[model samples]
Target: MRSVQRVDKCLAAACLVISRHAKFCEGARAMRLLLVTPIYPPTRGGIQTLLYQLTASLPGTDVKVITAKERGWEAHDASSGQLIKRVWVPEVSPLIRNAMFNFAALGALYGWRPDVVLCGHIVASPASWMIAKRFKAAHVVYAYGREIGIRPALAAWALRRSNAAIAISAYTRGELLAAAHGATLPPIHVVSPGVNLPDDIGRCDASRPTVLTVARMRDWYKGHDRLLDALPLVIQEVPNVHWVVIGEGKIRAELERRAKAAALLGNVSFLGEVDEDVKESWLSCAHVFAMPSRYPEDEAGGEGFGIVYLEAGARGLPSVASNIGAPTEVVVDGKTGILVDADSPPAIAAALIRLLTDADYARKLGSAARRRVETGFTWELVGQQLHSVLDEVAIAQSGP
Candidate 1:
């Protein structure tokens, strides 16, 4: 905790001294990389976080980012490292924003002439494809489960044109290949998501047992519906248990209505889109973390990897996850955290009951979760793997 605080203070202070420029860090690698994506910081989301971490620490590489012009986001991103070129094409219609961004990225690609053009988001792959081919750069696409599943045709076109891919998890890789419907797919590097680990873990308050779930509420597969249903039953078992629902989405009003109708107003909290400090506070204070995410009946729109589970684990919090998708890979059945049937209210309630009722056992699991993260899921390790994979692709495709 002390180390993290010191690091935060130092980083914050350095931000004031540093100007957001295109200068390469000393000893920056020889790679000339162009990252094209729709979303970037300070837009906020899992994708943005992953992209930021991946791009922020690269050494010796001439890096440039071309992202969509999201108001209030591009300004803060300069501090994130590399030269940011926001595709600020005006749209006559609001719905055509992506098209505008695509055209802007396409225009910038011809002159930049990067050795490797990576698609930060799957949606950015098409423009990257055109530019990579024209510039003779290795075209690499990132396959996140829903981004491909939602737009199968676009994903297919991008995948076919790309040379390689970076899949967030095995589940995501499988989902992408399945979404392809037998189209020839490129090599997928199964690089699981990582989280920032805390140096010190806050002690859990036995009296006010809190269950934390951080996710976009608009996502139906996130299983907020099932969690809400389980809450009443969970309250029956652990009367003092409180549920903290973090992050905002389209269904916030509906979820609030349901909670109120169920008379769980006081027990439930909706801390929508909290800052890092508040998020850290909640993660530290919370006793147990639960996000009963599941895939739809069509087996679509699921977690590629439960990064929030990793985040909770990193914070020394035990997770209660659904036994669907990549959670089985990230969260152990009993060692780190417990996994229950997806969308099963009874199972969720039972799991929560067990975690909230047994403090010693819950702490044991939390400790193990922390150990798991320390050994396997840190940003350092993830960055190393990602960098190596990208380097391999660039080297292999670099012409004789």
Candidate 2:
């Protein structure tokens, strides 16, 4: 009886604390959040999707988003249902665009004096630093893979002055620390991005196995060429296997030409930029999802975190992520899906064959993958993690 009373008391105290936090989120006194990013919806990708969900989840806070002008953002903004100021930068050269964006951010700093300024990428570190120093506000920056480097001394200096930094993966955090060496940097919090979990996408069509790879053919790192090389081997084992490639990029024609020259054109379908619903439908139809991604040979470009694996999992599809970089964080090697040497054709082929050939194993991995997303990598969970981080920063700044 005494223990039960103690538990009740503790619950009441917790509730009181939560209520106080709730008030901080709900009024004119709410935390003023300023988010600056180079990309956002309707330009969908891991980073944009994460920012969208995280922003949506943090309702009741005074949030302001400053981003570059893109085609679909107007539509997305209409659907967002939020009444925040949306600053748009005109399309131009990289340097000019960054200058314009920073100028806009500078204007916002003087006008609003945000309580916290959160930059979606380190590219805007200088603007974030200026906001933090000019006004007594917390400045935070996010580091994604391949985006951090040594050349931008100014950005690095800005990052060093930030109140905190968020890394999408442990690998990325390590990369950031190495890149920002010799600078007085703040603690980096590893916060993996999340996906919106879906209901079971139904069982795969066992009669005709399908392997889907969805990614824009923007760079060589996507490993589309490697996957194509493995196609013949995969076809040898699973005769009727069909490879579905969904995404559009400047190199699409080149990839298609290669597929045709190799006489594998009939087995492959390159569907350009697809609707969200259509993409989900394809995920539902796929038995296995594969993206043999790799790090660029030229420079510091690697997958910070792959959200596509989680998306595949949500649709009850097993993933075959590359055994490289932070993919290990998303796909649990044998449990979620097989991890193969992304650069090796034979390895990619073997992994794909194993998943498609053994229906029982594929289903088990798919189911496990879905459960993993539910337990950890959902958008709500990501938002909560970010919310907690922001709350911590706010609390520290409001120290008694």
Candidate 1 has an lDDT of 0.82
In model 2, which range of ten residues has the least summed lDDT? 149-158
Which clashing pairs does model 2 show? none
Instruction: List the pairs of residues colliding in candidate 1.
Output: 1-200, 28-59, 28-60, 29-59, 29-60, 29-61
Give one digit per residue, the lDDT tens place, for model 1 in 282-382. Answer: 88899999998888877456787878998999888999998878788888989988999977899999999999999899989999999999988888888
Question: Candidate 2, after superposition: displacement of residue 135 in Å?
Answer: 2.6
- Model 1 C-alpha RMSD vs. true structure (Å) is 10.9
Candidate 2 segments exceeding 4 Å error: 1-28, 109-113, 149-155, 204-207
| Model 2 lDDT per residue over 249-301, tens place | 98899999999999998789999999998888888888999997888668456
